[model samples]
Target: MNQLKLTVSILATAGLLFFIAACAQMGTLPSLPASHPEALAIGQQVNCAECHEDQQKGTLKPYKAFNHSPVFVKSHRFYAASDDRLCSTCHKSSFCNDCHTNKVQIKPSTKFGNRPDREMQHRGNFMTMHKIEGKLDPASCYRCHGRANNERCIQCHR
Candidate 1:
């Protein structure tokens, strides 16, 4: 009985040591300091609650604190314009190519599929109206199509 108890104690201690060793071998994850200096300098984080509502909230929240907001997609341009370096911290340069590919990508109508929502990009007979829209605001066209050489645009405009 005494030997059995001693064996159990040894096994428990060994198991605990192995667990600690394994945890140590797995390097810690990147963490935001209570106020990450760059984030504070950039004025993204004023307080802990900006990200961490609960103790584990910040740990689970994806990307940098402000990057996951619903408006981040629309608002990211302003932030990127101010400091692209901040954007680069999480978003790779390739991330831009997801939307802004240089090649002749599939049309959104085809890409979004042939569903009811997958009609023309604009409302009310866009194929007829797009000429007017393009002629009026070429800048808008240049967003997806490179200003220098857009074969798709040249095909129609020229």
Candidate 2:
């Protein structure tokens, strides 16, 4: 009788461990896409709430308020517009060229427009070589990385 009880207890313990492991694995899994059409469409809509749900709800909020701030508008600009051109509006070539030219290194050999390498007279755009080894630079990232962060590239690209 004692042996049977011990065996049952062992089985129960093993089952509990397996259940916990499964739960942990599930948490690590990527979230599935929205099932409903409306939900998927809503996902495309750029809003402060979309990225910063906690901040919007006033629970575990990162930023103080979402109003009357340049960051808020900046976040919306990239999300709603879905293009780098919006960024170029305020951050003119002069601003970018200052940092990119001075701090960052560029390769002049790379050709941008039509006409292959040294084929005909064409504009040669310098290529910036900033390697993203593993992690991102916190300082450089803060420009767009706001309270609510979305990893989906398609959200903005598409």
Candidate 3:
């Protein structure tokens, strides 16, 4: 009975810790900046720099910055895709082409190689292990090679 009680207590503690970590990761978002609402209300263009307090590294951080807010990461894709020139305001066309283009692709890995501590995609052994990974996550492959005539995919898949 005592052992079972200890086990249950340990599990309960672990569950609570997990819940706290998840809450931290799913950051609490404050209300949208006054500019967003005011811009929409008055039919004016929204300027992000107005609300963002600082620019660090490359990311434009909002006034109440918390490194990387989960809310922003989840919704940024929607904001980027809906506009034609919105991204150019903050990001170069080359930034979009890095992931979206079918041409001689420059891997994010190359850019991030200088910072070895940062989390990176397609690790050292990826080239050798990619076939199994591709089979498991075909959707990832399609992101870069969605074209029906993708020569890159054809080189291996065909």
lDDT of 3 by residue, 1-158 (tens): 99999999999999999999988976653433323333222222334445554643423334343312356443455556654343454446775565556654445667667755533457677667897898898887666545646665568766
Model 3 clash pairs are: none
lDDT of 2 by residue, 38-99 (tens): 32232122343555465532132332343324465445434335433433433355543322
Model 2 spans with C-alpha error above 4 angstroms: 37-158
Weakest 10 consecutive residues, lDDT, candidate 2?
119-128
lDDT of 1 by residue, 39-138 (tens): 4333232343555454444345433544444466545556666556645654577656544557746554455454433223454466788878989998
Model 3 ranges off by over 4 Å: 1-76, 115-120
Clashes of 2: 2
Number of colliding residue pairs in each model: 0, 2, 0
Looking at model 2, the pairs that clash are 51-148, 52-148
Query: Which model, 2 or 3, shows the larger TM-score?
Result: 3
RMSD of each: 16.8, 16.6, 14.2
Q: How far off is residue 82 in model 3, in Å?
A: 1.6
Error of 2 at 18 (Å): 0.9
